[model samples]
Target: MFKTLSRKTVYQNRWMKLHEDIIERPGGIEGLFGVVEKPDFSAIIAVDNGHIHLVEQYRYPIGQRSLELPMGGWPEQPDADPLALARGELQEETGYVAEHIEQIGYHHVDNGGGTMGCNVFFATGLTFSGRNPDPEEADLEPMTLPLTEFERRIKDGEILDACTIACYGLAKLKGLV
Candidate 1:
């Protein structure tokens, strides 16, 4: 296993911290590694009947709006409950609350370069009220599509978010979907 010889925080913000590390490789050679440290997030798959709710919003870093499952994290509250985050994000982004939320699985975001993982939840029996999006997510639009259509979108490359794909796949694999 590679050993961390030294690590230094190069930058930090509310959302993430960037670190530079010197590592002793398996062959005993020294090398540098850059990592982004961030708190985990939760992704929710809200399904009611045959429909699944999703959020579409402009992802600034990617310079385009993308479709994804309701997801968010509280970097300020890293130890926050995963189910709470999942529930809140679903209602905040999609204006839907699930009568039941089941944690399907967890996945690392970028094991090679980031210290972040996400908890995935399978939600059923949704009820829509109204959205409570944050200012940054003011433009988010939510849509409910047939579960089969949602899966087709993923297969057709219309849904490109890795977390969303991974979460939904895990749920489906576990026979929750």
Candidate 2:
């Protein structure tokens, strides 16, 4: 088994922290590892009458806007419940409140580099309510399209968000879609 000989925080901010660790493997081999520590998040696949709800927002890191499934985490409340987070994100980003929301799967975001995972949710029976996005999501735009078109966009390279694709795949595989 690998062992951590020493660890230190390399960087930190309100959303995440980076940690550097010196580790030892079997046979005395040693190396350094860098890990990003972030709060777990939720991804919601909101479906209504053969259509899917998506949010388009400017992703600062990519320097462009992306169309993705409603998803987010409450960094300030790191210990928030996943169900509540999923419900909140759905309404906050897409302005669609789900009459039914249930967790379908859970998986790591980036097992090699980040200590973060997501709870994938399947939401249906939606009702429209005006969005109340956070300041960071000031540029958020919500849209709904047929499920077949959503899949086509993914194939056409228009929807590039990993979490969105993965969550949709999981829900589909589980026959929730």
Q: Give me the displacement of residue 138 in model 2, in angstroms.
A: 0.4
Highest lDDT: give the candidate number. 2
Best by TM-score: 2
Candidate 2: tens digits of C-alpha lDDT, residues 113-144: 99999999999999999799999889999999
**Could you give candidate 1's per-residue lDDT for residues 1-177 as a string of tens digits?**
999999999999889999999999999999999999999999998888888899999999999999999999976788889999999889999998889998878889999999899999999988888889999888899988999999999999999999889888888888877
Worst 10 residues of 2 by lDDT: 168-177
CA-lDDT, candidates in order: 0.91, 0.94
Q: Model 2: what TM-score?
A: 0.98
Clashing pairs in 2: none
Question: For model 1, which pairs clash?
Answer: none
